[model samples]
Target: MGSGPTAVEIISHLNSSWQKVRGYQTETEVAEYRNGKLQITKSFLYSFRKPRDFRIDMHHPHRGTSLICCDAEGKILVRPGGIGAVFKKRLSPDNRLLADPSGQRIDQTDLGLLIRNIGHSLTDQRRGDMKVTDEGGRLVVESVASDHFLPGVLTRYRFVIEKGTWLPAQVVELTPEGVLKRVVTFGTVNLLSDFPPGFFISDREDRGGGGR
Candidate 1:
């Protein structure tokens, strides 16, 4: 029998799919952790559009909702009770709001970027830090980052890409000490050819708790 697709091959397919996608929306369950124990889990509705535009609606049952939107113009963060604020900045991978706990500026939850990183890990194998394995019926690609690159924290990111969709089912972030930092599980994904007008715009300007 022949070996199935390599990590690099799967990522190539994923990257090709991303190039043609105009936009996508998905429901995600985000879990934050510390010291290897489970912390809390939150649900979010995430949407992304081409040419740098994204929105996140974090659900808080009693407290309401938190909305974060980024586009070519700037970022808008809205608090639960209708208070929101806007900042002027173009949407890019370097945006501070998109920075992860390790100070790496990336859309940590993006499937496209996650797939691309798998390719990067394979390309630059100097550290021997990447591995591909089969786990829980998904293809798992794990990449480890050294402290030299990230300054302080030595981190590992794991991507579990589903076979059928070629999209990530879950993403895990672990610290140097093997502490589980965060895990995000993706739910239903909807690829959209057209979105509503001003869907990325926010009108709330509340300054409570630095919404974003």
Candidate 2:
């Protein structure tokens, strides 16, 4: 399918949809180039709420650690998995410990920011043309960026947006030379008006410790 929508048009629709979301939870899978081969590097259960409440529960690699950021404190409360769960640390948003291998901060991983970045790339004339096409029954927005729109890489981008919700279901980043760089998939998205009480409050915070 071709001649779907202009980049500007798609971004507008996505922003409208995103503004209606009060909260959401999703299972996320991140894959990236490692040792010159694309490998699934991390999997996590992510939860987010409006006004800056979010959580990340690592399921692979770390396997036990969880991070929670609540608007109350504006700091990341880390509860390590395994035996380390007994201890917790409250770190600044830019703390290296809160960063991924690609140096993406936890606070920057929200869907709103992702769409905004894509809008920036598409609106910049130097990034070349932006195209929206129907791929596998989804609207995929494709564009190329001359500069590193993402934190660490410059690449071509394909954002597969769920037609029903206008939210990104998957994002594929490729090297300018057309090699796969990274792909992040969002699955089982559940939208809610609000989480139950104490959802964003970690055990440490609940106990009044608030980490160190």
Candidate 3:
């Protein structure tokens, strides 16, 4: 459950993983192009083994999108259904975002910060004096209270990195009450040769004949 790996060590592992991923693959629905990019959109689903499911309308600009979800898996079900919504997005800046649309807020940063979090968690996990659980998992950084997700609660994190690519394939978030707050798993990475020309419309007016 515990390892000698320091925060630095975990960070290194995560960073190394990111480097392996040249980019993400996106799925599409009648894919189109505008402004020299591909616009792929679809309804997506993410599920965890413990019965957690997340839904999203994915709009992938380039790196593709994942319908991400998670929960305790393979029976021995501790929790299910997961918590909240997850929307994956990436930009030319190389930033990937998992956003909460209703929350009206998002972390502009993306994949790299996630790796740093893994490092931070690994460091904390190695602390000799922390509470130990026979069921192993990483700690969620900075918890708070309230209906948004409950107050003063701890959420444990678990994950799986893709082989060869090193991108995150799965992730989990569990509350102190053993309730699953979030779960996300990715699938079907599609490498496209070219995106549609109308893919990146600047404004409503630019939607052309497609405007509703």
Which candidate has the top score in lDDT? 2
For model 3 the local lDDT of residue 56 reads: 28
Superpose all Cα atoms of candidate 2 onto the true structure and report the RMSD in Å to 1 decimal: 2.7
lDDT of all predictions, in order shown?
A: 0.62, 0.78, 0.35
Kindly list the per-residue Cα lDDT of model 2 for residues 1-212, writing each as its tens digit: 24878776888998999999999999999998864487767899999998688999999978988888984658888878989876777887887666566556788888888877777767773366677788765798777774333454567888889988889899887876778777889996799897888788765444443433
Backbone clash pairs in model 3 (N, Cα, C under 3 Å; residues 3+ apart or in different chains), count: 21
Candidate 1 accuracy as lDDT: 0.62
Minimal lDDT window, size 10, model 3: 71-80
How badly does each model clash, as a count of residue pairs?
A: 4, 1, 21
- Candidate 3, residue 197: Cα displacement in angstroms equals 4.4
Judging by TM-score against the true structure, name the best candidate. 2
TM-score of 3: 0.42
Which 10 consecutive positions of candidate 2 have the poorest summed lDDT? 203-212
Q: TM-score for all predictions? A: 0.72, 0.88, 0.42
lDDT tens per residue, model 3, 1-212: 34333345445656886555433342212222233243333234222111122222244332233332221221111111224212212222111233342121223213445565555454543322222222233322222122222234344555555444444545444444445545444565433333333232122342121100
lDDT by residue (39-125, candidate 1, tens digit) is 677787888887556677767432345454563435445434444223323334555655655454434446666556556544553
Which structure is stronger by lDDT: 1 or 3? 1
Once superposed on the true structure, which residue ranges of model 1 sit more than 4 Å away at CA? 1-4, 61-63, 70-72, 82-109, 135-137, 146-152, 203-212
RMSD in Å for model 1: 5.1
